[model samples]
Target: MGDPIKKIELKDGTTRYRFVIDIGRDPATGKRRQLTKTYDTKKEARAEYAKVKHQTDEGMFVGPDKTTVSAWLDTWLKSTTVDVEKATAANYADALLPVRERLGGKRLQDVTEEDVDELVSWMLTSGRKRGGKVGSGLSVRSVQLTLGRFRSSLNVAMRRRLVVRNVAQYTQIPREARRKAAAMAALRVPWSETEVRQFLASIRGHRLHAPVLLALIGMRPAEVCGLRWSAVDLDAGTLSVELTRTLVEGEVEEKGPKSEKGKRKLPLPKPLHAALRAFKARQATEAIRAGELYERSGFVLVDELGVAWKTDRFRRAIHKLMEQAKVRKVRPYDARHACLTYLATSGVPDVIVSAWAGHADLSFTKRVYIHPNVEHLRQAADQLDELLG
Candidate 1:
């Protein structure tokens, strides 16, 4: 605290009020920090000074900031959030790259709604990178996720009184962008039942057949990679979902399931049970044959060396196998969608299907995971044909 207000004569002989207050020392550099304000009249300066005093008294005052968006994001990811997991923080750091590139240099308090609005437009147009291409527009979904995380980060800023409001709030994706997203989604069609059967036939008796089959049975790739031999009981014909191993920029990181429901026990189908038994025996034979080289990592998805498979490798392997089999190449996630769609179309109960997919919300499981092709809707079309006749 210092003098609340001081009247000073300007060069033009007019008067103004000024005040300076010691905020605190910068924790990073151990340098002193202060805030100085000049006002057109004593009354205004006194009012603002009182507000500052009240804030200080209430333990809500924030020091003057030289913090830019990038710096704040770095610090926030590292130190601000106590509950955020390392992988999630890594994702947040990644999602905010466009923000850092566009607005990182601006003072944290200086960013306005207009600036954020421009950022939204830029991200949806030519600000994103895709598939080795530079300056390609991001999908509308990607833009929405990036901005959603940005808005959450800005909420923390607001709580600290760094800004009076969230400058990044209330952003909406344009209709044109939404239409483009729909078109892109349509082009990424998942495999139909025939394609699924072809893929299964192609991967039959392969060393990684069991793990690949898990994906076709609605297991997330992370779940498949994370599975260990201990979680599977061939005698009981059950496989438990316990942990997940995911890739963070090419590094394998072990973590728990996404939710409580994600940790489930699924009864193995006869074919999958046989596949696992054969794979387990093969792995044992290889381990014994190459005793010194065997790592014995205990993971279900591993190479001959016993090292656990990460998602990227698994995804690529699946794609290669699809090409070799002459089957349409769809993402492993899309395979999970096809499986869920199959269950839904084949009269599986909605709750049971959701549980099998390790999802808490039945509607979400159906809406996001179930993808039906024209063949799947033939029954409805047939019924309509009869009705019209």
Candidate 2:
């Protein structure tokens, strides 16, 4: 009675829309029901209307509303019950918050594939700091992740009957090719025995020195920081990696080692063993004097205040040490790669090396090991012949 209903064909061949007359009683409220129903095509809309009219006569109808994509995303982010980790949720929120301007006003039900394409294209063409720098394009990787999250949000909306279709499902992101590493080694800067010595020489008497050396040997920073006195076996010349220290909101927090694989005993070289013994003696003397609980979590590493050292602070210290030593700066984690390369070229068995390093696969070790020096290869070949004989 208000206005005549009409069907409209969308540019996309697969769908059609219509504002149909509402004529049915609301099953729960006993009030009259009224609204629109969309269909796959114009022909299908007529069939759908016929079916809906019959259903309405018999009693079954629901109303649709004008919701925007950005509006629904906001609701989904705040209310969805997905079991995402804290760090992951923080990342999603950060990524989604800035894109509101791009999507906020667009009608969710009327969203087209072109809208998704244009938004992503604009993100990439725009700079790194989201409207900060003109020339710095967004990282392809971050853009890809943002798009994936968008798709996930849309999927939730579709499930709740908030959106008609998941338009983001069909969107695509262009790929960027891999880049090369500029380090001495592909993924590391394998310090020669001499370089290690020089590094130690520079950091002597420095608070973080011994732990840095221990890191170079094989232990991850977290594993080393988490080490407790109980985990140390001074006489046995080994250290048990039990806990890892992480920085949370600028404070050191101790947590169990990241994985079971991370909780292993590693034999310390003679120099490291001696250093730990010396470190213990010094720490014991200080603990007695300070009357403060000497952070006995036997961390092979700790800050000046006898508190656990954080991984990032430790990394920054390592870089500073590099600067002082005049060595090219390499990440502390690269020391793991350096150690693996040293073992591979030293004739250690691949399987044995894998277990020692807690690597899940031997192929991963092989792929990352440094290229052997020509002379070392010849030496290995000669040794192989002697062993074969």
Candidate 3:
């Protein structure tokens, strides 16, 4: 019931109006807390005062909070896990680590565009968390991911009234960083078809050939590792991709496909089907040889004793096979890239290629997975010549 409006005279003899409202008790000290608003005109002062009072009375008040960026990141992560898979949540945490390390102590509301921009620049220069030459920054892709995740968290903060705007809204990855990323990707192109055939020949009788072929045939390394014998139907010559055992924090964890489209049944290519049959027979013999010691984990990719392979192990196996085959090594995931590229260029329909890659977006599959080479371009030129000539 105290006086809510007061008039103040400034040193220049100008008058200003202010409204003061008592919010509620601060639980920490059991003291009354008041909110104040000042405006040049009495009308503006009255409007804000009425708004605050209504918000306070209606339990819609969002007062100043001092939640630090680091603390709120933790809260946001918990909220994130509810909406995304655990592996995705872990990836988000990895992306936000730079924010936590550099700006975590700052109040979330105080984060500015300059702060995020500087962080991005620093990440491009010195953000490598581990294992790089001194003064070398993280990769452009990693910095982009960090900035994106921070922007997302800030969006949540704005919705919760913790901040007025996303500080990272206008931030951008440096041009040099993007160019560098593009150049690096160009240098590390996936294996060509000749290399693919050579690698398969080299691994023909190898113990891990079946699993590596699964990767070469467009299955993700995690999917290859997670695939179970029960999910394969040799009689039907089809394989179901419904489960994935991916790594989170260096530990293997099982989960379902990332999306509904990802949970598809792909017809097994003939070579893959034959490889699987041979591998299955070999595993049966191994199980008999190991007797009670066999793990019988039901996974298709296993060791002599039936112990299943994880992504890292499967990746290493693929690399060793590549080296032995005299083929250049690429990341295991690139096998999927090569497969998709081959599928796209071999006259496979774009929609079919997208579905084969387990992606709902045809554009994404085309943009990211399908890489056209000079020979492909030459073929297009030949067709154009035929049309024009």
Best by lDDT: 3
lDDT of each candidate versus the true structure? 0.86, 0.69, 0.88
Taking all chains together, each candidate's TM-score versus the true structure is: 0.85, 0.68, 0.85
Off by over 4 Å in 1: 1-7, 11-64, 78-80, 129-131, 384-389
Question: Against the hidden true structure, what lDDT does model 2 obtain?
Answer: 0.69
Give the runs in model 3 whose Cα sits over 4 Å from its true position: 1-20, 23-32, 36-63, 131-135
Model 3, CA-based lDDT: 0.88
In candidate 2, what are the lDDT values of residues 1-389, reduced to their tens digit? 44333656566744455756676555347986576666655676677777767655754332454777677777788775367544445678767653565787877777778888887787777736643675565656666778888889888876655555778898777543123112323445466656767878888777565677788777777777677778889989888777777665456667665457666788888878877888877777777766765554445566544776678878888898899988767778878767777787788898877767766667877876544655557887899999999
Regions of candidate 2 where Cα sits further than 4 Å from its true position: 1-34, 37-85, 88-138, 155-197, 248-253, 288-298, 361-389
lDDT of 3 by residue, 24-114 (tens): 7664588988988889988888888898888779766667789999999998888877878777878898899899999999999888888
Output the worst ten-in-a-row residue range by lDDT, candidate 3: 127-136
For residues 229-289, could you state the per-residue lDDT of candidate 1 as single tens digits? 9999999999999999998776778999878999999999998999999999999998998
Candidate 3, residue 121: CA error in Å? 1.3
